[model samples]
Target: MNEIIPRYIYGFLNSGLLLIKYCRSCTVCSRLTRFPRYNDPKKLVETREGRCGEWANCFTLYCRAFGYESRLVAPYGVLTLILDFTDHVWTECYSQFLGRWMHLDPCEAIYDRPLLYEKGWNKKLNYAIAIAKDGVYDVTKRYTRKWHEVLSRRTMVTEPSLSSILTNITNETRRGFAPQLLSIIEARDIEENQQIERSLHSEDDESLSLPGRRSGNEQWRKSRSEIGSDNLSSSACPVRLCVDEHVTKIYNAFRPVLHQFIAEEVTKAEAVE
Candidate 1:
């Protein structure tokens, strides 16, 4: 007997087929109703939970069922434009072909049609960009840094990882050690004050020189500047959430079934080949 493929991969393929089958003729609400496992909005204000929950359920079930680990990630601030809420959810999957995690957002892709891409539309608020012409095929770029680096920048620390001995050595190594150390300490204090000043005046004052918030009409100027200054390669910065440990567990648990499905599909294709 031939070895069998997993069900999870078939589920993944089936999910796209299902979306195409059900969503082609149906309105968004109608398609949403079909997935009763996902919560739906009673009103516009009640949309966040429903929207987030729906994405989470589809991502988790479809991807996991296909043997891919998936998880819902919440970005830093208000991300979705559709609802007036401050958050959104997207899916992450580990791609063996890519040798790393990748992101997908079927919901955003489905919703961000050219006819639907409004200024305040929920899809427009998302940080992730879509690839499909119909905006149904989703792919996110990689752009995440280690947590320590983020903390280091926020705290004004020269090195993110400093052992006690390393700190002492650095203190003793410099010429005019005492004055240099004092100056470094003073500069940090001034920077902190400036950061606080910028935060306090950020809403009304445009002239504040802050680390991340720029003084201008451009909303993304600060983020752009940070990205440029970091000298990070494109792959280093994840545009979407990559697989972390927790998500990996979910994927691993589902992989056997998913792989079997993919294998079966591949075998069928090879038979035709």
Candidate 2:
């Protein structure tokens, strides 16, 4: 079902679903755009179109209807707010075939491309949380390869606070779950945690040559700075010059001082020789 749903959605969407780009605009002027921002899956089915959020929402509903445990994956900014094209929404279905959660983007019709945002779109995500009926999880590690850099960017909350918050949210979400279901979910979570840990240690060869953001047009993707990187190695550690910033000035000043120190040291070495 996990493998079949993406292809089905891809074909269904390509057939006739109109992707309303203006739906993302300010809702205050929604009357001007006259776009129906439908939240209900039934409404989405009737309308048959929307952005990644809608696609993920409706697709997640479909996964649940088919008895597959699913999650809505939301990649957000450091403030935990969904920023406009910088952020994206997707679905993750717990695959019975693999006994693990698999990433699925109905918009792109791609499956298991967990690094699509980080590697494919060259996005530096701060948090990629997975929200399900039973729990909320900080699944940032699943989506990013540069854990150290990601940790550096997560400045909104401390590690313990973030973990506590997520745990509280999960407990609230699972409050209504029966003991049997809760136990099953706990076991699954443990398995997934181990899987994610292993994934962090393992190198993904496919990440070397991931394609760009295929869901949006060239112009749109370029506008969002998500056109993606063909040269993964070069783009991975982008060195940006912080012109006129305090740190930049300090770095610039240090360069010549370090150069002078090296010259003097070399001269002293020559004298010794």
* Model 2 residue 101 distance off true place after TM-score fit, in angstroms: 0.5
Local lDDT at 203 for model 2? 84
**What's the TM-score of each model vs. the native?**
0.26, 0.69
In the range 40-88, model 2's lDDT, one tens digit per residue, is 6545655655667777887786566546778898876422322244578
What RMSD does model 2 have? 23.3
lDDT of 1 by residue, 1-273 (tens): 011112111122322321111111233333322221222111111222234435455454455544564544444232232233333455655465654335555444321122121112212222332211111111221222122333333332233333343344444544365777668644643553454344333343334221211111122333233212222234663322343344447646755654565557544334333
Score residue 59 of candidate 1 by CA lDDT.
59
Q: Identify the leading candidate in terms of lDDT.
A: 2
RMSD of 1: 20.6
Error of 1 at 60 (Å): 2.0
* Candidate RMSDs in order: 20.6, 23.3
After superposing candidate 1 on the true structure, give the runs of residues whose Cα lies further than 4 Å from its correct spot.
1-49, 77-84, 110-273
